[model samples]
Target: MKPKCGIVYNGHLQSDKFMVQLHWLSDTAKRHGFEPELIGNHRLIPAVIDGRCTLLGPYADYRPDFFFFWDKDIRLARHLEKMGFRLFNSASSIEICDDKSRTYEVLAEHGVTMPKTVTGPLLYEGFELEDVSSVPSIVAELGLPLVLKEAYGSFGEQVYLIASEEELIGRLKSLGAKPYVLQELVASSYGRDVRINVVGGEAAAAMLRRSETDFRANVTAGGRMFPYEPTDEEKAFAVRCAELVGADFAGVDLLFGPDGEPVLCEINSNAHFKNIFDCTGVDLAEAMFRYIRSVLYAADGSRKGDAPC
Candidate 1:
């Protein structure tokens, strides 16, 4: 019997890029002899909770063998995992990766080399100088032209380069101090970084994201993507970062520190693959399916072995 796969994606198929990813996954599944079902955003929650059922829009309900969370939204993963769905990159991993502050903590715990960073409440909400005093210390230790970021931001949004103390304080006050992270900026980056895609504990592909005009190097932020091959040390660092967070698959961003060492920047659980696929010709969705199949098959075999025969 062909295994049924359910892919949970934002229902807005209006974007040509999103539609292309969906088509690629569907085609790959068909080629692999699996029944492919695309579950839009509306029906995703109920379908996962109901188990082995299908849902039509907001009404129908269905369960699937495996659930693929395609969006950066972390809440979906949390809800589905609670309902006992087999999910890639698990909910806890998603939550940790989604919050920049938490990501730093986890990476640090694993003894990964990363930029000197300070994470706390948003600037607008008002942080006590005493409570967040370490932020200034990091600045003084690492030197000026630092990066200030929101705890939950994507596509290079809400990230700022602070060149002076006034600019740093002003930006913090403007943001209302909700929750943010301040880090030592890597000036040599020239608004560029390496994004490595890892699956099943291996590095699939890597690309250099460069934006000479802006401080952010996200492709959507007017950056360019070029093929990149990480050195052995770089590759090992990327893989270890992903493993530290327990992600089934991940996109690890790395930057060069002052000492010219590869430092962890951030990790994305539900990484965008359109740009990566365009640059590397690696069909991640297909690779993901194959990996999932292997895991499920192994588990089934283990169950049979344990059964009283």
Candidate 2:
């Protein structure tokens, strides 16, 4: 019998690309000799009952050998781990990648080449900074114009360009204690960046994103995409980032430095692959399914003989 993979995804996410990717993932699992089931996050309610932990709700009688976690429900992911189920892009890695501050904190210690950054203070109801209006040391270090990104946001909606001290204060006041980061704007990569999809510790595919009217070059934000060929240095850097994050597969964004060197932007644990597939004609889903199969079998062979996941 083939192993079962519960592809857990967010049902509330309503998007064409989201649905398409899920379909592709399911199809690829079948092609790779696995039984795939689409399990929404709502179905897997983590709970403890009768002195034991278990998944309840509409999960039915379907038990998975391992899970392909596509949702960002960290608690549920951890619960699944407690049950000894193997998950691609493990829960801790997802948590770090989900929050910008955590991602920077983990990578910064390793001397990754990224923008100069400062994580925002903890949020409280009446918290206020003393010198946001004076270009204080924080602003002084990051400069007059910098990038203020909310720690938790996607699709470039919460990222802002603070061009003046007043704008910084006003934006902070509006933010009202939400966690954020202050980063020195890498002017050289304005409205442009590269997205490299790394699978099984290799750069599988890449694309260049550019925008004519917006500083943020996200495809959902109206950016144009073109096939990109990363240099050997760029490919190696991206693979290193994915390994550092402990992701089986990930999308690594790179910003161009002043001298055109690649700078680490951020890592996406659950990066949307449809855009990359469309631009590069490379199917990350296929690569990912195949890669995980090998990993699961290799472990089984080395440990308990003939076991399957």
Candidate 3:
């Protein structure tokens, strides 16, 4: 019998932008000889019941050999892991990638090269920042035209450029107790960066993202895409970042340093690959499937012939 693969996705985020990838994943799983089941995040309930942890919901009875967790619902992802289900891009990796601040700290601890960053404090109590004393020191360190990013965000929507102290304060005031990070701006990579998709510890595909009108080079923000050939340094750097985060598959964004070196931006555990596919004509879902199959084989060595891919 073929191994059952659960393709878990967020139910709330149902727009085409989100749904398109799920379809691709599901289709690829079938072609790769697995029984693919699309499970909604809401439908798979993990809870505490009868003095023991329980998975209770409409789809509670259904269990897959493994899960492709495709959402940032950290709580749910962790619960699935606790229930003894193996997750691609493990729960811890997803949590780290979901929060940019955590991503930086983990990478930096291992001496990975990236921008100079200062992570802001967490204010979980109220909606007001009681003190503004640290603002000056942050400004002094990063200087004007620094990058301010909310710790937890995606698609460059929560990232901003502070060109002045006033603008910086304005942005922080609006943030109001949310966790954030301030980093030195790589002027050389102002409106351009490279998105490298890594699968199974290898650089699968890459593209250059450039924006003439915005500092963030995300396609959602009107950036143009062009095929990019990564240097050995970039390929190794990106692969290292993905490995450090424990992601089975990931998209690593790299900024161009002054000397054409690669600087880390952030890593995405469940990176949206439709954009990369459109840009590079590489189907990441297929790559991911192959990797997962190999992973299952490496785990037990008994599934080598189970519905062979």
RMSD of every candidate to native, in Å, equals 4.4, 2.4, 2.7
Q: TM-score of each candidate? A: 0.84, 0.93, 0.95
TM-score of 2: 0.93
| lDDT for each candidate structure | 0.77, 0.87, 0.88
Sort by lDDT, top down from the best: 3, 2, 1
Expressed as tens digits, the lDDT of each residue in 106-205 for candidate 1 is 8886779887887765443344443435556666876788889899887788888889877877776666646888888778675888999888888888
What ranking of all candidate models by TM-score puts the best one first? 3, 2, 1
Best by TM-score: 3
Judging by TM-score, tell me the better candidate of 2 and 3: 3
Stretches of candidate 3 exceeding 4 Å from the true structure? 298-301, 304-309
Candidate 3 local Cα displacement, residue 229, angstroms: 0.6
Model 2, C-alpha of 48: deviation from truth (Å): 2.0
For candidate 2, write residues 125-192 as lDDT tens digits. 78766545434778889986899999988877799999987888888878887899989999999999
Candidate 3 Cα deviation (angstroms), residue 72: 1.1
